[model samples]
Target: MTPELLRARIKGGEPLMDLDLRQLVLTPGDYAGAVFMRCDLRGVNLAGVDLRDSQFIRCQLQDTIWDGAQLDQCVFHGSNASGARMRAASIKEMNWSDSQAIGMDMSEAQWVSVNFVKTDMTDVCLKGASLKQVSFTECAWGKADMSGTRQEQVLYMYGDLTQALLQDAHWDGVVCVESDLSGQDFHGQTLQRCQLTECRLEGCNFQDALLEQTNFKGAFMRGAKLINARASRAMFVYADLQEAHCQGGRYTQSLWADACLDHADLSGADLTQSILHRTRCNGASFMNAELEYADFSYADVSRADFRGSRFMRTQFHRALIAGTRWGNKAGVLEKDPLLFEAEQWSAGRPTAPRAGY
Candidate 1:
């Protein structure tokens, strides 16, 4: 198709479907609200075109240059958009799904509410892009570079995250499910309310970061560093946190039910109002920590240290305390530990205040 022929057809409002338009020379013209289905636009130079609200379904758009195009409210479904360049494009309210966007370069683009469902985004470059309220569902990603991007409220529901590079990215309210973000650096970043359920976070650094109300349910957080992190009310239910460093952190009201805290150092940490029911706390440390209102019911605290810890209303109901060290506690001391201690474990024990009045 020639440039004049294509312009005439578009101006005449003709159906541009199932046509071989690989020979068309695109000029700066208005193609807005145009619908092209099953069209082979391979290697088309559609740069700087006005394609706003345009729909392209099952189109062959491989290596197409859409850079500086106005793609606002555009729909691109079931299209082979591999190696397409859409850099610095204004793409808002776009709905793209079931498409192959592999090796697509969308760097420095302005995206808002851009949804991609069931799409293949392998080796996609989104560096320095600004995204707001964007979502990716059931997408197959591989080595997607999201470096230096400013993102807000992004939701990723897929799990096949092969080598996602998010270096120097600013995130707010990011949520992921079953995603493997292992070995990512989140140091000192504010990740409030970020839910990473059933995800693999192995060797992830969250040191001194603000992780308030972040959910890590059924996550693998082994060797993760959370030192001095303000992670109050965070959920780690059924998470394996073996050898994780959480020393001197504020973990108030956090839940770790059936989770593994073995070999983790929580020294001088404030675990007030926390719950660890049926959890494995083997070889953990709580030295000089505050355990007020914390519950450890049915948990195994074997070989754990509680030296110089201050506890009030901290329950260890039916918990295995064998080989656990307890000393310098500010709470009620057991006077008759050899006798009536098993009775105390069976029933609620009586407490006496320190006679300092």
Candidate 2:
């Protein structure tokens, strides 16, 4: 279909369906409010065109170019736009559900309140894009490059973001629940109040990042690097951090209940007022760490190093300290037999005989 014909049909309120518009160089025209059903638009270039409020249902848009196009309020349901390029497009309030957008280039695009539900956007380039209130539900975003992207209130639920490049991305209030973000690099990024619950973040690098008040509950962060990260008030309940390097990180008031930190290095970390109830910190190093007012009740610290650590007002009640090293001492709890006593003393164990013996 030629650009003039397409414009004339749209202006005439006629739907363009079942047409083969392959390799068509659509001129810069206003094709807003057009309905394109079952159309073959493969390799078509719609650069600098105005396609606002357009509906593309079950269309084949393979390798199509939409660079710098206006796609506000557009809906693309069940359409295949694989390898399509929409770079620097103004895409607002766009709904693209159940579409195949694999390898699509949307770099530097301005997206607001856009939804991409159940779409295959794998390896899509969204670098330097500005996204506000954007949601990507159940989408396959594996290896997608979102580096340097600025996002606000972005919801990424149940998406496969494995090996995705998000380095230097500025996130604010971003919630990524149940997403597979394993092995992704977020090094030195500032993620304030971000919720990444139940996500797979194993082998990911978060070194020197500011993750204040971030919720990572039930996340698989094994072997993840968090060295020098500022993660105050963060939650990691039931999460796995085994063998993870967290040396010199500030984790004040963080919760690690039932989490696994076995063989993890936490040397010089400030864990004051943090909770570690029932957590496994076996063979973990806490040398010179500030553990004042921290709770480790019922936690297993077997063979863990606490030498030169400050533990004032720290709770270690019912914790297993076998082979654990303290400053200038090792396994020397013989002097304090009452150290094994529970916080609540058992009844019927009279200290100075019954009052009415």
Candidate 3:
């Protein structure tokens, strides 16, 4: 139908149509007002075309090639564009909501102010792309290749970016609220003021990343690897980081109130000037770690290891220390219980050691 006319216009060099253009190779043409609704445009080649303000609503555009195309202000609502190739395209201010774009290769493309709301873009490639102010709200971008992408001011609320390849990407001022970033690698990335609340980040890797003032409240990061990370003024309130490997990480002035760190390894790490108020570190390892000016008030350090760790001016008031290996390398507390209780508590304060914990 319209696809035959488009091919005739491309061959006869007449003009392109504005209707359903499915399975056609009409390249090097201008396609203004191109509307492709309910069309199957699989294997169609529309490369090097100018499609200004075009719309593709409810279309099946699988394996379509749109390389080097100019698609300004275009919309792709509820379309299926799986395995499509859109490399190096100039797509500015496009809206692509609720689209199923699995396995699409959009590497090195220009996506300025694009909206990808509620789209399923699994295994898509965006390597070396500049995505400034892009909104991916409620999008499923699982296993997407975002490596080396410069993403500034991106909002990814309720998005599933689990296992995505974000290695060495610049994510400054990115907000990822309620997103699943589990098993994602953020090694050596700079993340400032990032909000990650109530997300499932189990087994995620953030090794050696500069995380200044990041909020990780109520997130589940059990068994995550954050080794050698630099975190200053970061907040982890009530977060579950059980068995996480954070060896050699710098936690200067970080706040970790009421967070669970059971069986986590913090060996050779710097915990200087950090707040660990009421934090549960049961069975955790802190061997040879720096604990200068760190607070462990009312914390549970039972069955925890702190051998050869620096504890200069570090508070240990009301902390449970049964079967704990202290800096003296002993399995028991050396001080008398009554004398230690008398040093901090007074008369009639019900200070009979608080009824043995």
The clash numbers for all candidates, in the given order, read 0, 0, 0
TM-score of each: 0.85, 0.87, 0.78
What value does the lDDT take at residue 216 in candidate 3?
86
lDDT of 2 by residue, 245-340 (tens): 999999999999999999999999999999999999999999999888888888999999999888766887778999999885332222223654
lDDT digits (tens) for residues 147-169 of candidate 3: 99988788888877777888788
Q: 2 or 3, which is superior by lDDT? A: 2
Estimate, for each residue in 1-357, the C-alpha lDDT of model 1 and write its tens digit: 667777677778776899998887887888887789999999989999988888899999999999999899999999999999999987889999999999999999989989999999999999999998999999877899998888888998855664888777777778898888888877877778888889999989888888899899999999999999999999999999999999999999999999999998999999999998999999999898889988887889899999988988687877888999999545522232533477767678667687995
CA shift at 229, candidate 1, in angstroms? 2.4
Sort the predicted structures by TM-score, highest score first: 2, 1, 3
Local distance difference test, per candidate? 0.88, 0.90, 0.82
> Which runs in model 3 stand beyond 4 Å of their true positions?
1-18, 23-35, 39-41, 189-192, 328-357
Write down the TM-score for model 3: 0.78
> 14 in model 3: Cα distance from truth in Å?
19
Considering only N, C-alpha and C atoms within 3 Å, which residue pairs clash in candidate 3?
Answer: none
Q: Relative to the unseen true structure, what is the C-alpha lDDT of residue 334 in candidate 2, on a scale of 0 to 100?
A: 28
lDDT of 3 at 311: 74
Better of 2 and 3 by TM-score: 2
Pick the winner on lDDT between candidates 1 and 3: 1
